[model samples]
Structure formats: structure tokens, C-alpha cells
Target: MKTFACALAALAIVASAPAAFAEDRSSARKAQDNGTRQIPVCRKNLGTVAIIEPDNQWWREFNLGSPEAILRVFVQQSRCFTLVNRGRSLQNSAMERALAEQGELQGGSNIGKGQIKAADYFLQPDIVSTNNNSGGGGIGGVLGGVGGLFGHGVGAIAGGLNIKKGEANVTLSIVNSRTTVEEALTEGYARKSDVSFGAGGGGFFGGTFGGVGGGGYQNTQIGQIIVLAYLDAYTKLVSQLGGLPENASAAAPPAK
Candidate 1:
């Protein structure tokens, strides 16, 4: 019976070898491909850190930033100092997960505790967020068909029948460890369809939202440049305060 159990154990090890090898290979590929991922360096040296997750249900799908824009991920203490992580969140999450599954985060946490390190942050940017528009009207087909009613019901019906869609803006915020250290508000406008950033610049969409108090998220028009540019300005504010810690492996030319 002892000999049989030993044989079974050996068989199990052999059976698991290929699966383990494949997992390791998968992790290695991820580590390589995700190397260029990063977040912005926080401008203010705060003791606490905060992160804002993108809400796809409202905001359009954004690939971080455009090719021209740059992203940097780092750590910092609120109202204190900022530190660039040797590993950005995207890449580190990969490494961290692998460690966690293998019980390595336990050791990391030990070292991380009381380590004078700040919290983590992510920054996604799109440099060339522009829009342009050409004006025209599409009343030809309807106008021709309405030739008979154009003199009568057309005027009254058209006045109240033109349907308009409203736009919404989203702002994401976070409070860490019972204290509000950081907040990131990403205000973006949504259209019925995807729009060219350059073409839609300087345009506004107005409509009503259905909610109580006759007060819903209204007057929602955020310019592409103004929204993204606000990030740049905020980042600078954190940096000048010397809130982030230094990261030796930090990339100078963020991934294109």
C-alpha cells in the first residue's frame, strides 16, 4: 500500500508538470509585453495615494491615451512625497498576482508595512484629442414628401417632434483608509454615436435627464483638451510638492 501511494504521488507530479510549465511561460510573456505600461508621476508629495477606475458604462472606451500621449504610474504619501515605483501598477499587478497566488505578497507586505512608502496611482493620457465639424442640413427627403402638409401640419409637428439626445459627464473619486487623500474626476461627454475628437470640439449637446428634484446631471459639456489638459496641470501640482518617491527603473520616455 505504501509503495502504491508513492507511485500515485509521482504520477500526480508528472501530470502537473506540463500545466505548471505552461503557466510560467504565460506569465513570462505577460511580463514582457506589459513592460511599457505605467502611470503618471504624482505632482504633489502626499502621504496617501488614490486611484480612479474608468466607468465604461458611461464614458467611451479609452485606450489609456493616444499614441502621442504619455502615461506614468507611481506611489506617494498624501501631502508629503511621491515615489515612482520600479514597477508600474499594470505590470506590477501581474507580478503581484503571481506572487500572491504563491503566497509571496505575504513577504512583500511585511516589508511594505511601515516602509515610509505612499499609495499607488495610474495616469492615462491621449495627446491628440481633437475634434472638427462641418455643418449641413438633411431636410430634403422629408421636405419633398411633406410638400402637401408643408403648408399646414408640418410647421406645428416639426416644432415638437425633433428628438434630441442628452450628454452625460462622469467624475470618479476615491478615499483611502478612511481619509480622502486623492480624487480624480474624469469628465467626458457621451454622444449617441462615437465622434471624431477634432470635429466635435467647441460643440455642446443639451438635453434633460429624468431624476428627482428636477435636478439631474445637467449642463454637461466638457471639452476634450480641457479635460485631458487638467490632468497635466494637476500632475505638475503634485510633483512640485515633492510628494513622490524616486524610482530608478522609471521610464523617461513613457510608452508611445
Candidate 2:
């Protein structure tokens, strides 16, 4: 009877374990879906917009493709505005005209000069990142001390457990092309934290993992923050342009 009771209890636990795991999985899926859902923000198109590279030197030095990529993707996906290539329009038009003039030689029809659509607004993106250190008194220090016992030569293995934090600020602005007046400004901020772990030192067998490591433009702590900030700014821009009732028809300035 005692053996039978134990078996029954074990079976009950096994059955309940699956249920608990399924509940946890369901919760995680729900959270993930919520985070990925797109918020509908733009209702009407805001006319043609020209994107300009960020003026910040930091952005240039970072060598990350301009935040224009983010804005372009967001605007295109939202159908908020018709994008225009201000820089290439003129050159493309001239080339087209030249091709038309030589159409006979190339056995092609003479195409008339293409009409260039003037941009109604220009968009600019700027980003700034800064590092934040929270001291070395946490589990990192404990781990480092433990690693030290293994030998100072391999101390980096434990040092890699150190925490790193960073913050990013992103700003997007819309300016009227005709009036050169700022129409809308949106800002987004993001904070990111991660553990520092890397392999370096000595020969093939002498490598140690420890110390602060930096990530590439889009993969590091700052990069993650930049991406988050852009998402936030884009969300706000869409909300202002289309989500709110009062701002539904107020997205663009009146034409002079």
C-alpha cells in the first residue's frame, strides 16, 4: 500500500509538471506577441518627404548606416508619407534626358523629361549614446574573486561576468521644405545592460575571458538602445499624425 501511494504521488507530479510548463510557455508567447504588435498610428498620407543624414558627428563616426533606414522602414510600413529622393532626382532626371536624346541610336523611344516631385517636408534623425557604470560590488566582484583563486592568469574568465550598461537618445524632426520651419519633433530614449565576456590573452591555450567588450554598431548595448529609441520615436510620430483624434487632420502645415 505504501509503494502504491508513492507511485500515485509521482504520477500526479509528472502530470502537473506539464501543465505548469504549458502555462509558462503560454504566458511567454502572449508577452512576445504583445511586444511585436504594431500600433496603428498614421491615418492619412503626409505627402512626399525627403530624408537627410544625421548632422551629428557621433553618428557619422559610428559608421552605422544613418537612422534614415529606420525612419524609411517605419514610414513605408505605416504608409504615412510618400518618400522622395531629393539628392538623386536631379541627376536621375538629367540622365534620363540624355538617354532620351540618344534613343534613336539605342533603338528606344524618346522619353520626355520626367517631372520631379518637390518634397513637402524633410526628416532628420540624430542619436547619442553614453556609458553608465554601476560600480563593481555585485555578483561580478564575487565571481572575480572566485576566478582569482583559479589563478590571476585566468582571472579574466570571471571578470567577464562584470555588468555593463548604456543609454541612447534618439531624436527625429520634421521640417517644412518651403518654409524651413520645424513642424514636428519626436524623441526616444533607451537603456540597455549586458554582461561583459570575451576571449583574449596569451597563446591558443592561454586565452582568458574577462574585461569590458564592445559590440558592433547594431549588436552592442548602445546599438540595442538606439534601435529601441527609434522604435519609440516612430511610434510617437505615428500616434501624433494619426492615432489621436485631435491630431488626425493636423499632421501637415497648411500650404502657403
Give Cα-based local distance difference scores for all models.
Answer: 0.29, 0.48
lDDT for each residue of candidate 2 in 39-63, tens digit (9 for 90 to 100) = 2224456677888875333443333
For residue 130, give model 2's deviation from the true position in Å. 4.0
Lowest-sum lDDT 10-residue window in model 1: 1-10
- Tell me the number of clashing residue pairs for each predicted model: 35, 1
The RMSD of every model to the true structure, in order and in angstroms, is: 23.0, 17.3
- lDDT score at residue 80, model 1, on the 0-100 scale: 28
What TM-score fits each model? 0.27, 0.55
Q: What clash count does candidate 2 reach?
A: 1
